[model samples]
Target: MRGLSRGPPAARPPRPPGRNGPAYTPQRMADVSAPEPPKPPPTLPDAEIAALREAGRAWEKAPGRSSAGPEVAPGLDVAETRGRPGEHYVRIVRSQTQGFEPVAPGWLEATPRAIAPDTDFGRIRRRLRTALLGSPLSIHRVLHERLDKVRALPVLSSDALSSVAYATEQIVLILAVAGTAAISADLLPIMGVIALLIIIVCLSYRQTIKAYPQGGGSYIVAKDNLGPVAGLIAGSALMTDYILTVAVSVASGYDQIQSVFPAAVHYRVAACITVVVLIAVANLRGLRQAGNIFAAPTYLFIGAIILTVTVNLFRLITGSIHPTGTSIHIPMTESFTDLGGMVLVLLFLKAFSSGCSALTGIEAISDGILAFKVPEWRNARTTLTIMGTLCVVMFCGITIGTEVL
Candidate 1:
């Protein structure tokens, strides 16, 4: 049969008026073309169709599909259009099955289309996505590989650990407001207390990891043991904590940069935004890239802080340093203070609460156990332990350094 062109057919002369004002001649119109018969759908080999149909039967019988039935039709994949007029390119279908000799998922992509894929917008979209995020990965390529303890420490803990960059700064800033005397007298004790708090939190999480090997946190614990409302509250609190971490980290980082080049102080907002964007883009590239990119800074910060503290400790032990004196002089902000015992405690507690915000990012590894490699839970727990140990050391050292140096 001839194909009907998408363009209009040949023009016809107008019908002439008759005695009845119009003609009604069905028989005369027989010369005109009739609508074409519908083409039967293309099919696969009987054996292949039978296997697929049988395989899809359970899926077809599932609740949502019950009304429409299996998408497979009369032993045809429907998607397969070979042996029909539209068939052109070769079709390569990988058999879907489990067990040994697993099929590779590449040369495995296909999408049923009325037009060719290369000519479709899908090409442009895929290309753009690839340009932005590297090559596309097959769904099968997702990993369960675990991180070793050293690598895991930074990969899973960078966010929480970044707080070390500014936690002490924040504490000192707050304590300085009362007076230089007030800061010198109270800063060490408050910081030490906060460091102790960090250790306790880390130990508590260790217990939590062991107790809930499946990775239950405050939300799950609250839900399971304390009911849904408590779980919701915990989740909301966590969200708030994360938001504050992002904001405070950026703000404090801005202050640090400002210290080095005070002129950049005005650009703080823009710089912070750029950093956040870069972080988001890195994370979007996947966890592997993120770990590679972020792990260095975390360790560098730890190494620098630890090294500086060790020097101070050596000096203190050798009687070459006085703990009462400040190391690098920090210009004091103008402030007044005539506080007594209880008011001082309140001020210190408030500062500690702000510094404790560093703990916010610790939940990343706990919440993401499945992202770890083989023996997922065990590796995740090990990572958590290492991170906790690092956090303890860093917190204690920073406090001590600030106190003595």
Candidate 2:
């Protein structure tokens, strides 16, 4: 045993006891330990907090993270920011204050600044002004120059007056279809009703114009008075009406032209397209310039109708008038009784109502009240009166002419 024994076998130093006894130490106990918790971030200074709030506000107003802030004023820095916490920082730099700048002071309150004298900017500016405010010599100008135009108005008034021509045609067509006899009896009453409706519409639109001087028209009124949905409906209806006006006016004009030049009878679409192009060109030229060009024709058209009606009225009262070619043997449609009496009357009424199309432009003046010059309300009012009178006269003349013929 002494010869074969290992040194380690002699050194059995310790053995762990069972429960409650001392335990043996492990050699690798210190290798893997639990980590400690992290520390909190540093607090921001008062100046940094204020700067952050201001930056946030600026970003909200006009979103960007640049250094620019409010305009430089006395003891104020437009460009300055507090540095991060626990870091070096720079305060807002100070500057001198500059007072308010006038957009336009004397000539017109905020008159648009004139463009460069040598550049096309002048022409563009002039065109823009003309489109928005109208020329000094045109009906549009007169409307813009006075507030009364909002109530009574001119260019749109003339448009209303022009409606009489088309309105009478609609009535005559309705009556002729109903039978020549029906026309002779109902014509005057129908005219009276239509006239009454026109007046009502005019009055309604006048109130609308006064209430909303902005150009939203029916859309604005509906939105303000009714709600957004109603405004949308009004807007859609107006757009539809404008489209119909273009189509109907051109088609009717084409028919008139065809009567004189039978060769053009088949070219109705072409004529309509031409008229649309012309209108677009006019619009592109700017409202004021176009108004200047159209003023003479508009007035002449009124004058012509007035002169013709006055002469015709005198002749009719004196028993010397002769009917025109179309009026002499006016053809009546025979499809009325076939459609049933009640249905036909309803149809005629509907047509008569449609003829009230003349009243469509009545609100345009009011919508554009802001377009007028100084003393806006007064200018608008005067223009409105002129428009109303002209419209009344023109409507009456056209109605009577249709009746007499």
Which has the greatest TM-score?
1
Off by over 4 Å in 1: 1-121, 144-146, 322-339
Worst 10 residues of 2 by lDDT: 107-116
Residue 315 in candidate 2, Cα distance off native in Å: 1.5
After TM-score superposition, the amount by which residue 69's alpha carbon in candidate 2 deviates from its true location, in angstroms, is 14
Q: Provide C-alpha RMSD values for all models, in order.
A: 18.6, 18.1
CA lDDT of each prediction against the hidden true structure: 0.70, 0.65
lDDT of 1: 0.70
Please provide, for model 2 over 45-150, each residue's C-alpha lDDT reduced to its tens digit, 9 standing for 90 to 100.
8899889999888787885555668653333335655768877566543222222223342212212232224468877887786765454253434454332332
State which candidate has the highest lDDT: 1
Model 1: per-residue Cα lDDT over 153-252, one tens digit each: 7767887788876777777777765555666787777766776776777677767766777776778878988899999999999888888788887887
Of candidate 1, the 10-residue stretch with the lowest lDDT total is: 94-103
